[model samples]
Target: MVVARTRTTCVLGALLGGALLVSGCGDDSSDDAFSGQKADDIAAKAVAATDKASSVHMKGTAKVKGASTVGLDIRVDDQGNCTGTISGDGARAQLLRSKGGDVLIKGDRAFWTNSARAGGGDAKQGEQLAGKLAGKWVTAPADGPDAAFCDKKRFLASMDQDKTERQGMKRGTETEVDGEDALTLEKEQEGNRISMHVATEGEPYILKAATAGSEDSTMTFDDYGEKVKVQPPSQDEIVDPADTQA
Candidate 1:
């Protein structure tokens, strides 16, 4: 059996470290598209469209000072299944879902290193650990400890969030996300400034969203209803913490 995973630097632990990576991105290839409408109005339509589709391919990054900075690249299904990697600090973890609707997370040795750091382990231990479990998989059931934060339904719903109720939300900038034209809905509410981008051409799907100032966070949404297949880690390579912990 493997040495016990320190609750301090667990792969599942990072779930506690950051926010959602917004879903969906990209626009229709057609030339004629929605324009000249309010940012919130366009965003509302995009959210409605996404809600109607119910899934997307999402990617983004978020950083909070003195905390882990996470980068997420994942594909989410309408039913709330995510298959992707959340990488940051000294670790990388992959979240996968089975067709039977089970979601599981697996992390690399670096994940343990980071978990150790979070748990207060020193750097040398992490280095020694790297050689011990590199490329090995430490698995966690999504419903298990520290895994509730990765609920797929909650992650999907976050993309449709529109802050039209904010006191002073308005159009901010016209930018290009990977060459696709985008419109940003800008706002400042109670000292927090937010900018959300939507495609100006196709379906108005969210292109990205960001908050300015300290504790920076950004999420970009696109690829509604694309085919996503997530397979589980092989049993031979899987190690459950519960087994050894017991």
Candidate 2:
């Protein structure tokens, strides 16, 4: 949220930050034999844990070819509900979908069409259409070509199954993220890399997955199991494509 003129500071993803520290205790997992686990086992376990969580808070930066870079902030619920904003290059868009698959898009005109069109990727085309779509809401189809980005739960839940894209995964380091005990696992293929920050102290959740120099973009995960409720915009605000003045 950006603060308008008056005098106030907006907040974005504020959280308690601290590394998970291991104290002297019976399990003393700091020295546990996790080192003996196979790379495949670790990778598989991380994937399994992430899938099981079925929900999370995600935020990150992703490079968009014609759009420069975009910042993504999203929350996904177990029932496949997702809500978030993707903003960059002076443009921003709000997106949401219910568990039933109805999609709603609000904000930047360029963003709405780019996401709602099956063949929409022309940068020039987006701007032109955006001019005509001011103050309009797009009710997109569930299976639209661009719906993938709007449906985080469905996309990420199957990340572990991308065996062909992930390779040579090896443990990197034992650390903490957002105050949780975490272990790093990394894999690279064809110059694309995915580094997973897997929680080690509890249920082995994939706390975060960061990708740099990849077509997939960089993203982070947190606040697993947090409730994320989305309310649809009011009816009159929606702009039917057929009824548009443009």
lDDT of 1 by residue, 63-142 (tens): 65556766778787655466877787767877776543445656677776666566666888666655555565555555
Residue 126 displacement in candidate 1 (angstroms): 8.1
Q: Model 2 clash pairs?
A: none
lDDT of each: 0.58, 0.55
List runs of model 1 lying over 4 Å from the truth.
Answer: 1-11, 20-37, 116-134, 144-151, 158-167, 189-193
lDDT of 2 by residue, 1-246 (tens): 000011101111111011111001011123242556664566667666666785777777655333355566878776758798757545576778788476666666645445334233466655666676645666666666334445554545334333544445666778888888877766554565556676777676666666556344555678887788888778887766666534
How far is 242's C-alpha from truth in model 2 (Å)? 3.1
TM-score of 1: 0.69
How many backbone collisions does model 1 have? 11
- lDDT score of residue 70 within candidate 2: 55
